[model samples]
Target chain A: MSVELISRDNGIVAVITGEIDHHAAAQIRTEIDFALERQTPSLLIFDMSGVTFMDSSGIGLILGRQRITESYGGAVAVKNPSPCARRIITLAGLSTLIIEGKKENKNEAR
Target chain B: MKHDNYFKITLPALSRNESFARAAVSAFAAQLDPTVDKIGDIKAAVSEAVTNCIVHAYADSPVVGVVEITAKIKDDTLYIKIRDKGCGIDDIKQAMTPLFTSKPEEERAGLGFAVMESCCDKLKVTSTPGKGTTVTLTVRLDKKELA
Candidate 1:
């Protein structure tokens, strides 16, 4: 899986595409973390509308990002998760972090 | 009696192989005519099992170990066995507990077995310390409905 960062409202929206397993988590984590360290946005949004598949590793990815972002007084939100992804996230007890998929202009990051 | 329809594959216990292993099994499971949702469940569980093999089982070892996956159809049940030759769990019960991960520092949510259990009809794990681990996941795909 790959993450494309979109800057909006003083935050970063990471649009993830492809299946996220333990294998793909490494690269995806690094890219997002790098953006966090550089931009240090006030919010981190995981737009999973393109995520066709994700397991526990995906949960871990989000949790880890939350931990990092929290230390910097930042926030995280998951947008438009697939049914399977929503089920696993809810099972992991992170459903509260999800946001409705609505009203976002696609502003590509620099 | 054992079902004659089955397939086995052996691959290096690498993280990248997780996707490959799950896809292979899903393809084989097509014979059961399972719904896309059921197939999604099977794929997620398979990914978790294979990840454990790569992360926990072969975590310390520099040598790339092997993961064996076998899928079989018996009656309406789909049986999947994911075996790994690595440092097996010392306590299977503890390992299966939700939010219990040996590699917590690595951000492992420790929900592998929990996810597997929720997705499958039956979840069984057997491990031998320093030997290996075999995770058996069974899903009932009401093939009768399709028939």
Candidate 2:
């Protein structure tokens, strides 16, 4: 998967696309970490709407990012995860990290 | 009862193939006309097992070994076997334990087997310490749809 960094209000948004497996996780981790380390923002958002597939490797990626952000007193959240990624995320018990993705959709519909 | 299908693939246990292995199995399982959630579950389980081979099975070895994936469908249950001829697990119980990763340095959460077990109906692991490991995942399909 590839990550595109965008500067949101106070947090940085990482729009990730493609499949995330062991190989792709490493790359996505590196890219996100590089950005996180560079900016050291207080908040980071992961946009995974374009991710076609994800397994535990994706879980590891999110967990690692959470660990990193915690170390620096920053927060990380997930947004717009695809159906597959959402299932994996919830199964991994990181449903707390999900935000805006589900809630925002409801708001927009209303 | 006409859902009888079988296929096997052997490829080097490279991290890159994790995607192929899982996707191939998902595509094959799709013949069951399972829900998207079911497809996601199968793919996640397949990936966890395949990742084990790429990251641990062939680890610390001079050569990248091969991981064999054999899939069969019968009675509407999908059975998959991911086999690798590399360093095997000494303690199956310990390896299957959640948050019990052998490679913590690589940011492994040790939740591979946990994810596999959660996603599939049954998980079986057989291994010989010095020989290799074989992980079997079984998923019972839902012939009906609810979405």
Candidate 3:
């Protein structure tokens, strides 16, 4: 699986493309973390539209990213998650932190 | 019951090894056309087992370890075993608890075991404190059980 980063002034968007199974977890984690740390955006959006596969490790990646973003008083959002990816995210009960939409929910950070 | 076509792969005990494990099992399970949900579950179980090996088993040590994965077709069922000879769990019960993670700093949801349990027909975990942990999962083929 491959991950691409698009940094914006408002937030840094991570476009994760490929199968996010156990194998891709570590590298994805490292790249995302580095991007988040370097950009330090108030919001981090993960675009999973291109993700064809995902598992529990993907859930961990979301949780880990959320924790890191929240630590800096920032928030994380997941946008356009594929059907399969959404199922796993919802199964993990992480919908509270990660949302689906175009406009950002600014209130969630508080 | 005598069966044929079994495969075993030993992956490096690293965080990146999960993909290999998942692919190996997915290839084996493809004959069943397991639903997307079932495939996801299988991958999840594999992830939990591998993650445990990477984060907890080999904790801080650079010593390379091995995660042995075995897949066998028996009696219309696919059994997958993931074994890691790293730091063994002291308390299986506590370790299996939902959201009970040894490392909170890593932002672990601690739902690995729960996810694995949800994904497979049967999930069994056997661990020796100093020896290692073995996670055995059985997924009954869809047709035979359905019929």
Q: How do the residues A1-110 of candidate 2 rate in per-residue lDDT, one tens digit apiece?
A: 67777875567788888888888989888888898888888988888888988877788888888888889899989997888888878877889988864423212221
True contacts kept of 3: 0.61
Candidate 3 residues A10-77, lDDT tens each? 78878888888655767888998888877788988888877887776788788888788899999888
User: Compared with the true structure, what per-residue lDDT tens digits does model 1 show for residues B47-119?
Assistant: 9999999999999888999999999888778899999889989988888889999997777899999999999
Q: After superposition, how far is residue B114 of candidate 1 from its true place, in Å?
A: 0.5
Where does candidate 2 stray beyond 4 Å? A101-110, B1-3
Which 10-residue window in model 2 chain A sums to the lowest lDDT? A101-110
Q: What is the TM-score of chain A in candidate 2?
A: 0.87
Give the least accurate 10-residue stretch of model 3 chain A, judged by summed lDDT.
Answer: A101-110
Using TM-score, give the best candidate's number.
1
Distance from true position, residue A71, model 3, in Å? 3.3
By DockQ, who's the top model here? Answer: 1
lDDT of 3 by residue, B85-125 (tens): 88789999998988788887665668778878877899999
Model 1 chain A lDDT-worst window of ten: A101-110
Give the poorly placed runs of model 3, Cα more than 4 Å off. Answer: A21-23, A101-110, B1-5, B60-62, B144-147
Clash count for each candidate, listed in order shown: 0, 0, 1
lDDT of 1 by residue, A26-84 (tens): 88899999999998888999988788898999999999999999998998999988788
Return the lDDT, model 3, position B114. 84
Q: List the residue pairs that clash in candidate 1.
A: none
Model 3 chain B lDDT-worst window of ten: B138-147
